[model samples]
Target: MAPIERRSGRKRALVNGEDIEKKNTLKRSLRQRTDTVKKEKPSTDKVNNNNINIDKKKVLESSSKENVEPPSLASNLPKALSCLNRVQPGIQGFIPHGLHSNNILYRLQHNAMGITRERSLRQAVVQSYSDQLANYRILTTASPFDRRVTAMQWHPTLPTTVAVGSKGGDLILWDFTKTEGITFMQGIGAGGSVTHLQFDTTDPSFIYTSSIDGKVSRQDFHGNNKTVFLNTMDWSYWYCSLDVNYRSNVLVSGDNLGNTVLMTRQGEKVWSHRLHKSKVTHCEFNKQCEWLLVTASTDKMVKMWDIRMVSGRKSALYELPHDRPINSAYFSPDCSRLLTTDQNSEIRVYGGPLWDKMERTIPHPHRFFQHITPIKASWHPIHELIVIGRYPDPQFPGYHHGENRTIDVFDANTGDMVCQMLDGSAKGIISLCQFNRDGSYLAAGMGLNTLIWTDVAKLTTQGALSVNKTISGIGLNPNRGSNTSQRRRNRRNNNDDEVDKLKKKLKTKTKTKTQTKTKTQTKSKSSRR
Candidate 1:
């Protein structure tokens, strides 16, 4: 009886040990699962910071459509080929009937096919433009200084060169053509926030800059700089704006003292006029006339001046009055029209000699002018559109009531809002905006951040290409760039080194032959003697 009882006890102990091992296995599995879940989870901090990045737009797009491809034109290709085959070579016109076969069904099939193929080609062209427009994205961003980028200018002739001036008086020169990295050169500091900046037409390295402290300066990318215009007067008066006409070697400037002044490139005051009752907000030179200058002031007036007249007789040739302070005044590409943005949140266009002819008045997106910082609008090179930054809506869930950080593009001729660009997911205020020479890119000064956007209005040629029903029949090509085959041909043409080498070899061979002939003649004379 004692032996049997011991055996039962040992069996019970073994069962309990097996149960303990099972419990330990379950715990280990639970721990491993918890670690895997933790590893996959997004850290809370990373999510918050990425919201401000411009890639938010791309993220929004990806979530809505997972790699959805554009409609393929391949299916229509065979039909188009069949229609083309019906037509004979050396002929521009299409065939109404299939020869040899002479089948009525074949002729009718191609007749319908011809119309359908042309329509598809036109639709494909239109679709291509829409896709091109959708691809406008931020190429790159540079903000070296902690201060706000106040003004920026692209080199008129150079594709990759750009200059930016910040509120902290720092000048940053950036060149994108370098493959190693973007080359950054910091020049001498300005007196105050750089209100305006431009490139030297003759010298790629030199640039002109104007500051709020009444100092106009010239700086080279090598850090060498000299103040061309100094404010020795009351010091209370600061330069409100400055513009240089490199063709005439003259500078047209405006100041807080309500003075419109013209000076030489060396900084000698040639002409000065105190026309506005308040600060002169902006000044522009007419592209058509080197002597013509346009000035807009906070006193609600825009005046055009021909610098050829005497200082006393330098009265404005045209007077444009506004209900609010004019922040910016620009002439159209043709110089036949004028545009201005006012504190009233309006973009006004005028024509005629006196600019009394009102063409259109388009309102900006950020209409309430309660803020002191005035918003600016720019003209597309073709004069077909104007783009300005829009203020945020007050009703946006977490939006602050004050500044609108988005951009609104408007049609100048039709006075309609065409498109808009937002400032990522974060709230940022763009104080000023400027279009590049070709109107391909737009640079907006958003506090310390300079937002560069691919302007959607650049579809000027594509929009033209899609207008007509037939591709070749319209006789107008609206492609923004050269045809792909033409571009390849150009690349081939650029490789002329082989031809140059062959020409050089021929010249050398001819010289050697002439020397050999002279030597051989001398040898023959020697042998005869």
Candidate 2:
């Protein structure tokens, strides 16, 4: 075999010749496999549903030849090889892998549980607190001044006008009767802080502003006169608070010097009381008795005073003791209850003729979580619920990320939190909040901004939607309309006469004064020469 020679005359060993033959055979087998796969790939693309028509007659005829022995192969094959004879391979399902019995059912003599426990809890909520409120919305938070708003009060008869006193000592009156027709005006002074504002009950345009300059000026929008009544000499201390009693035609004002002065409607001092050792933070009159007054101070005492009993310090009726400085002391709308709040986040409700008996003390919803500052609580006009505004106490356990502040409603009687309205902007601390007489609107003063939450549903029913486009042309009632029109006509007549007479008188006086001044100047120049 080692001496073999090829017929082509090239010398080749028998071992090398056999190796070449085996290599050629392996290459032929690989080329055949690749050629067959290429052919099968194109045949798959040529497949069409219409060309493979399934005939029932063919299938029935083929069924009769089932007795024939199947062709032997490496594996068992489906007889017809249809698509239905195959299935998706998975771990478990209604049909088990290789026909195993995993999914099962039992009759159990007709007794059964309809739904699993996990599924039962996935149903709709039964106590839906979201449905209790109507179409409530925060219209806006407006801060017109450079500093935090200090004083705020709503117009007595009108829901549209809210008088806000800025820390700059200017009163900005916002008219939201028609938001598009809103207007504001600067009032009184930039002399000092306008600490408080109280609108007159009988007059829509008449409002009183207390300034830190020791001046309480009665500003009326009805006329051009801003200072109808200004008592500067009597009130030497900055006026901290002011309240008007329309029935008694009197005004009660508390000062930073702990002096509470009772003034008549004409700004005449009727009486004065100086018993508090600290500044009077708040003062409010009882709805039933205009003579009765409750003033809260930093002295930790809420003292009640009657203008009629203005004899001495003995005239002070009752003093409510508090653990911390009292922030607000207000009587309920019906005059049947009294509410007091302290800097320690304590709220107390009192009932009885003199509000001497304590009804309940509401728990702080924020608990021991510390707020950077405290806020006053507002009582619902017709219910036993009070709204307490709070921000997410950063001191809350595990608290790191701050959230939007919330105004929580709580039951005044049971001390349970009811609902909450989130301040989506996460604005600064809320300082003041109050409800209207009918409780249709809530005004919250947060930081330098005033946020008004209006009961749009209740307002719509009351024909607020029918308000005219004119800022002051809302016809709320026919009687009020007629009365206002008459008063306006009379005021116009008086103003016209006064302006004409005063203008003529002023012109004549100025002419005379200028002539005299000119003559005096000429003489002085001659003397100098």
Per-candidate TM equals: 0.57, 0.57
436-459: candidate 1 lDDT, tens digit per residue? 777666666665545555634433
Q: Clashing pairs in model 1?
A: 391-404, 392-404
Candidate 2 residue lDDT tens string, 1-529: 3545556567554446555554555445434533554454453343333433334343334433443222231011122222223454777637433222111232111124432232122111111222243334454445554445677787777765677776667566776555453445554445467778888777767778787777777766433676645455653558788888888888888887788888888878787878688889889889897778888998889878777876765667887888888777878777777888787557888885856788888755333224222366777766666777764555554445756567777665556565766534435566677767666677777655566776546446656443212234321121123334646876999999999999999999999999999999999999999
Error of 2 at 429 (Å): 1.7
- Poorest 10 consecutive residues of model 1 by lDDT? 467-476
For residue 460, give model 1's deviation from the true position in Å. 22
Q: Which lDDT value does model 2 have at 321? A: 87
Candidate 2 residue pairs in backbone clash: none
